[model samples]
Target: MTADRAAAPAVTAGRAPAGEDFGVYLVTDTELAERHGHGVLGVARAAVAAGVRIVQVRDKTASARDLLALTAAVAEAVGDRALVVVDDRLDVVLAARHAGHRVAGVHLGQSDVPAGVARAVLGPDAHVGLTANTTRHLVEVAAMPSGTVDLLGVGVVHPTSTKPDHPPALGVAGFARIAATTPVPCVGIGGVELADVGPLRDAGAAGIAVVSGICAAPDPGAAAAAFVAAWDGAGR
Candidate 1:
């Protein structure tokens, strides 16, 4: 292990997970950010300033080098304002950590690397997350050794062009059904908006993850603040 990984805390079962509040998770979409005249890093900085507690740098199309560069930039931009996670890129996470960036961890899709393996590679303290849209998925994650995973990015809560291939939109009701069954914290994603925050929270979601709601907003910071207000108002 590198010095940074060696120095990282060992997060075992029974310990407090890193992303407990999860309140206002922001998943970046470069296209959406660019549409609003902000690069991913710029938008992330703005959102973090407005209470976005978690920022996931997700660029499926970028080259590995570019993604690493982007992740490092985001790590710098958010600083300690938010936990910086790279979506579906374990190598990038390791590389970023090796380079001395404060990338907290990674968010993996169900099809990506297994959480157990990710935890092993990232060491115990890395805040690993996984996607779970079905009851079976939830059960599988629940069965994992504790501390192997930190959070669940549960959804396609609504239809979203950002992930056209995502399984059928879960909608609020479907989302609630899945969220209710999970032991780990769930952040409702995919087409989520400010109005859905209270309802999703009421439905047992620990947080709300958004792309366009903030990334494409005319004012990213204000949009993020709205999400924060809605989440807090729900008493989460």
Candidate 2:
């Protein structure tokens, strides 16, 4: 079910409608879930119930077939509860959506397929999130056509083992600097945690994307709820 062979559907079946919050984004890690004894599906089900507005299915190690299956499972479990996006893989997003599973979009790194091309391919209704950490990168996104990107993930908010090669850590101030330069909603990602939510929200971040924070939590739902609580409290 590669992108090239998948039917060019309008992604109508399971795509989540717009207007959902991006706050408290959850990026899953299969190994982390395994270590925590709550498989990816379990964590996704619980986390969304606790207000994780966006769920990104990011299993770097999974095969294309496996990833597509994972996306379908997550989407089915989430239903209309949250947007389910594939991390760094446009093809799987397409394959899953083609199969009638509700997959919202894909999150791509700067080096992945250009966001503009992705936009052209997925059409206006799809939700796309791009990883851009610098002022220059964000400026590039700003210049693109409207709806080319729905969200911008900027970070490495604090050093963590998740992405060892992650660019220099972008503290709230650094993240704020980059975030201020982009018009699209900026989601602070990388090593984000529960405590970082308010400061990030205060720093102009629209949301915070976490991996291990929720995946490896003693209780995934509680951890997600805490992050949502912090973000909500910050606005008061």
Candidate 3:
């Protein structure tokens, strides 16, 4: 279907596996990963090994082919240990999956391709996330068929250069207010840090997506582990 035509879920309403953990999401930036003598794939592997539940491939500078290669390589490297999603690139997701990679799906923006079209294109088995902070954006997702969007990345929890264009920061209380209005799972993103994990989770965030907190770290694995530990111990 065209990106603009009215779209519907390709199948029934779906949710991620009950066992899936949205507690710690790692969004990779090749440049940040490279800052400490690491590559995106290498960082991704390290994070996943540390119990990171989701890894999203999001390198703004990478060409289509390069992104596809990295996504596939990450999927291969991550194996079934965690889910790998392409940030705002449904094309690379399709290509990587076409090449027999296990890309879970994509995370798109309000300005990127419409979430509905992406939902139709990728089907229900795929996990689709749309960046949303405003209640209006959450409403947009609520209007779609049950499975049209499986996840929502909802914040700029703090200011971060990784996504200079991020929406106004949605601190824990704000995020919780948004989370309260929707049943769909939401992961807080933007400049989230290790210390933000437990509070975000406690505030009702299904997870907190990290960029510099892990990618630019001297040790991404340890960084990821700390985040995971914080999430696991939240509210205890």
- Cα RMSD of all models vs. native, in order, equals 5.7, 6.6, 7.2
| For model 3, the run of ten residues with the poorest summed lDDT | 1-10
Whole-model lDDT per candidate: 0.82, 0.81, 0.81
| Each candidate structure's count of clashing pairs | 0, 1, 0
TM-score of 2: 0.91
Give the runs in model 1 whose Cα sits over 4 Å from its true position: 1-19
Ranking by lDDT: 1, 2, 3
Model 2 RMSD vs true structure? 6.6
Candidate 3 structure quality by residue, lDDT tens digits, 76-146: 88846677889998899889888888788899989899988988888867889899889789878889887
List model 1 lDDT by residue over 123-216, tens digit each: 8767888999987898899889987888888889999998989899999999889877877888899999877988898888878899988999
**Model 2 local distance difference test score:** 0.81
Model 2 residue runs over 4 Å out of place are: 1-21
Give TM-scores for every candidate, taking all chains together and pairing residue i with residue i.
0.91, 0.91, 0.90
Error of 2 at 223 (Å): 1.0
Clashes of 1: 0
Q: Candidate 2 — worst ten consecutive residues by lDDT sum?
A: 1-10
